[model samples]
Target chain A: MSLRPLLIPALLLASLIALFGALLLGSTPMEASRVLAALAGMADATDVTVVWQVRLPRALAAFAVGLALGGSGAALQGLLRNPLAEPGVLGVSASASLGATFALYYGFFSVSAWLVPVAAVAGALLATMLIAAAAMRTSSVVTLILIGVGLSSFAGAAMSLLMNLAPNPFSLSDMINWMLGSVANRGFPDIVFAAPFIAAGLTILYAGRRGLTALTLGDEAAAGIGLDLRRQRLLVVAGAGLATGGAVALAGAIGFVGIVAPHIVRPLVDHDPARSLIPSALLAGLILVLADIGVRLLPTEFELKLGVVAALIGAPAFVWIAMQRRTISAEQG
Target chain B: MTDSEQKFELTVEKLCIRAGGSLLVENASLDLRSGELAVLLGPNGAGKTSLLRGILGLAPTATGSVRLQGRAFGEFNPQQRARRLSYLPQRRPLAWPSPVRDVVSLGRYAWGCAPGRLGAEDLGAVNAALAACDLLAMAERSTDTLSGGELARVHCARAFATEAPLLFADEPVASLDPRHRFRIMQLIRDHVSTGAGALVVLHDVSLAARFADRLIWMKEGRITADGPPTQTLTESRMAEIYQVQADINGNHVEITNPLP
Candidate 1:
């Protein structure tokens, strides 16, 4: 496959290695040989159960959510042509989190375990549809970002109100924990719910790859090149939102992977903004898997939030990017 | 038929375009054909760009119809219309360090080639476009690092890559050096002569007269003078449309006075 098509699989494999490393080498201390042996189908029954049943699915959840968040950010930023744009930053994640909260409050999901992420995806679709409707009016990048921010502020406020009205203190914690975001206890059910949405989002983003490529020349130029700006914008918004919403539902509010991963991987693709998506998705998986491991490896016994870890990692990364951008622009000037 | 034997025409009739609560281009009509390089010349905000946008169907045509190849352009999907017509706006910003080749490949978007791959025709059109604009050497360089003139040429290369039968370029040569400007003018003129139709907007009346086969003098939201460039660049029409006297001698029209 000449490493082009294989790039994703390779990155996935590397991420799998890292995920295994995280599982095998946690603070609990499992032997490396035992870990590899279990993974390689040679471990005893107890080791196999520990490696396969307990930790494997959680690792899978991180990978899936990370890929969605990263890919969603790339697709959104590409559609808006704004580096500052991110799925969580733009409010899709919050909207879906709110959706999950609402779904929980009604006791609707108490009757069914699968309803949580599904409700979150619904919330995500609503937010995405709204953003698309508003952004389609103007082709300006600034206007699109501004509209995203506006929608995000509204969704955030509504989500806060929903938090206030939670049926009980425990429900509030559930809501809070959901917003704080985590991939720790996620199982195959979460993956099944989120995967199809992310897959759909990827398909749309892939389909609009040509338009995104054209848009780098500016909207008029893209139009000149026969790209349907409105249609492409709508598709991207929906795709980015759906995938991102699914992640939010599965992981709560894992932050900055969507933004930082794309920025980090841009250099790998020679800065072709359109081709940055695949690498962004892969790198998101890498960063998240490593971050999840760090959460497990923390000195304290109490589990720290994964979102906190990401913010800690991503905040510095964001600052570095801003500094780099300023230095580059100053040099250019 | 050879490009020389073919004749493509663009017809804009009863066209009206409004923006920001004003008629930027109203009741405008014009014709452009092969063997004719038309220049839409006027002062800034004289509706030159608006008229161009209307013909390209980018602007909201409140009233009017544009015909490309005698087909109702209004009925053509925007992308379908874009396949036959190319446009160069006054300014375009590269938000990323998009490679010059990748930028130009946008012109082949109407071809709808698959991602991570290009077909033979798409590759040919891209290559021909790069060759046409003389941008082959720097095709691998990032456009964001290009100088203003180089970026202009890169955009020109992109527009040409569309391989459209009609071209609407708005101040395309504005930031170019004299050498590049002259070369670009010659390139536009040659392409027009080779069967494709073009309307190039210009502020330099003399260049319009010297290079364009026809003149479209847009003034205050309308075509004030439209005819052969030599016939239209006269003192009265220039004074009427531009509100300044023009010194017209044979094919030359000077907007600036000589040293006393």
Candidate 2:
């Protein structure tokens, strides 16, 4: 049998292995037997505290954030019918980061931790709405992409303005660290705050995946085949918004995972956008967990940030994929 | 007694289509009955495509009413409309390099079946369409690997797989070779012979004269003539519409030269 049928299952197995490896390797390494016993709640108190309190939430947080980005990326690429379409490139992640930064700058997190996530979701939703509206008004794909670029630039400018008027160095540093993105010291409460939005978003994306499949035939033909363009746009925008917002809230602005994971999984799924969703999500989650593990294993004096590590790996893959696409198109021409 | 073939499958009345602040089709009216193959003929800017789009509700209609099978067009939802009328647009856009079988299976979308998970009936329909289009050999190949003519046939197979009662094809034979063009026209003719209706746009006058049961001629957003091919296509009409001298024989049109 071909490798297509075995891909998702293999990714699942890899994810389990990665999660276990993440629990085992940290600043203070522990034995596998002790970690398994601690997971079963029969180990010493120190092992239990370290396993249950410290590593478990951080690992799960990284996986969940990856799931959000990868799934959203696949959906957006299908909707736009563009290989390069992703939350980071389309401005949704940057907008969500701006919202979280706003909350951080204004001391809203001091009042309640939930405010940051809520603000990020709001930012993502607003950006998605603007893009969807522009999509309806024009039939040009380049125009829609340019609008996204404009939105990203505007959000970046607004973020810089907030940083320029910081009240204190402590809050400014907090903003900077959040922007860089890491899962260290993350607890269950952080996961609890972002889980529902992510789940809802992914569920909606799964439900509307058939629309993405129909969209392979282009917009007018898809519409002619009884696929409702308006409804499809709504599902993609709202789903991507909620999921990316939650990821930004949980980890903060992780980029390129969305683009790279889907690109890798597309060929495996035979390039059907509907079938690519779950595999892309699984592969991306595995990638982030592995990246987090790499972060801990490095010999740097200071622990590396997860977002920085992800970009360091993902940016190169992105360039390679772009080059591969150019070569294919040129060959076709 | 009037048979089932006499019943009207589609009717458009006083339709006006507008785009970019200009009227594309103005006060156009036509009716297609079961088992009838109609061809639309026009100059480049004569609004043949616009009329088809206006009737299908794909374009912005300023004023018009369409009825399919005796029911108002607005009464049916998108799925219901798709089951009744299938459209093959001029521009064929395939985003990804999906396999040919997968793309053809998308015709079953209105029936709630995706490409990988097709029911028995859907699979039968897809296989039949592939065979009809002579694409069974390329079923496993990616669409991006196909030539221009092959891609056009793929889109045609996708439309045929739907098996809708009414088919509207916009320049389906534009990119095809002579043999394939005749093959596609014969396919449409055969499809209508099964008590279905088809309205196709064609640029080849000889092909339309041979296959189309009726001809509808449009000029500057208005239809100027509508009838059987022999009566509608004449020397004077050709000169008036195309500004060319032409000789019209039985199922053959020979244009001598453009009028200076």
Candidate 3:
């Protein structure tokens, strides 16, 4: 039996429920009716402020970031022909985070709220273009992945050096907090700023979906099937860069969402790379929103970092998937 | 243009392929036409695969021109090229566990239907291919669950699903059992018999002799011989090229290498 007919609707519904549940969580639990009233634009001013300004924006930001990560992850996986490939695997997230950190260090955040995301998007495009150039020269998946690892390590070192050379403790703490990843204190403007980049990335990925599916047969066969492989690679790389850069700009370098989200959707979609994209985005959005709520509800003095909770949940899930793949390949072989 | 040329014809002239400063195929030329099963046979490192890749435009040509029908090979758009030919590489490990039918439908990729949403025409082609490859029963099975032979048949079905006038297959029966090897060879022969062009590479000379209408034998990046199988697969030629002793009786060939 095929579950695909039900999977998309089920995921969309689940995401909606999660978003609603997320809106109701905080220091004081609000009634669903009041939440619904806020959504319908008929709530009192205090309720409207709490629901609209605070919870709604954070929820939307989390969802948008997840959407970008998920779409970026699925596209990267298709382009590299490796299930383990993700936006972070190609160093886009790390580079974007470094760009954001540079913005904070130079006080660009104070100048214009959009400058940090702009820098992050620039950084991501730079790293992805480098990777795409390397990919053109070599057809080996291992070589491409190794190039990504090198780029990621270099970006990490650069970020560490920036933090080491901070002129003041205040800027250092701010950089540190951003690195931890969060959806807190994010206003509606942040979501608006990141949405276009994410939308462009997702559109690019969607356009390449068929070619990506054809590529599962490998490069020569894919080309025979009329897929312009070079063009396909560029679309995936550029798309992943824009999406991941925007995501990191809104919520720091949230690790593992890209890697974990696709795995969750692959089985439900019969493991078709093309079919997995939208579903993976929805699932990732749901996962991030729920994680954001959990961090808020934690009993700690300060809310836990969103990235911390995600990595905590997602890292183990990634390990489990790797182990499962090993066993499956072992049995098949 | 003549009706024959209008149908399909791929002409390679003085094609040379170089990789990493080493010449893989040197000044090899061949004309592939509809209604023919041409075999490329050679010993290891003899540039057979390189020649095949060169013809498919997967390898860069140092000094050569390839023309499809009356146009330069490079001039055709991707969809136009794909509509003309389909290729089955030697190593095709279905990366995803997509169902057999879905995998086959990917061959119709040039049609530009929405991904995973096959039209009736696409489904008809896919079913015909699955039936041709005797994989109809296994169409619903996940590719990862298939045996090596089964997976090979699935790849053939995928190539067949394209319904292109020309097909190129490199070592289609490299590591299969005899039953599967014969089945795949027969399928290729059948495809060409319907007035389609086929260029196949095979390590098994006996299979090549049985299935190919014409043979192009290569040695050290050059065509050592090209003719009917009887003329090309001569006992003396096999000894010179393969470094093996062989016996030929009528249509049968037996390789009896007298170890030095």
Give me the candidate number with maximum TM-score: 2
lDDT of 3 by residue, B1-260 (tens): 01224578899999998878788998999988998899998899999888877877777555698898868887888877787888888777567888988888888898775336889888888888899889999888888888888888888888888888888999999889999999999998887876679999998888899999888989999987888897777888888778888898755778887635
- Candidate 1 ranges with C-alpha deviation above 4 Å: A1-6, A27-49, A111-115, A129-157, A168-176, A326-333, B1-6, B114-116, B256-260
lDDT of 2 by residue, A1-333 (tens): 187888989999999999999999998898899999999999999999999999999999999999999999999889888777778767888899899888866788888988988889989888887877876787565687688789888887898788778553455545555566788889999999989889989999999999999999988889888898889999999999999999989998788899999999998888999999999988989999999999989999988899999889887887787788789868977
lDDT of each: 0.77, 0.87, 0.84
> How high is each candidate's TM-score?
0.90, 0.95, 0.94
Best by lDDT: 2
Report the lDDT tens digits of candidate 3 across residue range A1-333.
576788889989999998999889998899999999988889999888999999999999999999999988887877766677776766788889889888867788889978888889888888888877876677666687677788778888898888778653455546555666899999999888888888898998998887778888888788888888888988887888888889989998887888899997887777788989899988899999999999999999977889999889877886787677778778976
**Native contacts present in each candidate (fraction):** 0.76, 0.77, 0.70
Task: Report the lDDT of model 3 for residue A17.
Answer: 92
Clashes of 3: 0
Q: Per-residue lDDT tens digits of candidate 1, residues B1-260? A: 13336567778898988877888887999888766788889888898888877787778545797886788888888778877788888768676787788778877777775324578877888888788878899988887678877888788778877778788899988867877788788888877766777899987777778888888888889888788865777887877777776678977776553222
Q: Cα deviation in Å at residue B111, candidate 3?
A: 1.7
Error of 1 at B38 (Å): 0.8
Candidate 2 per-residue lDDT, tens place, B2-119, comes to 1234455688999998888888999999998878899999889999988887887777555788998779886888887787788888777888999999999998888788989899
Off by over 4 Å in 2: A134-147, A167-173, A331-333, B1-8
Give the clashing pairs for model 2.
Answer: none
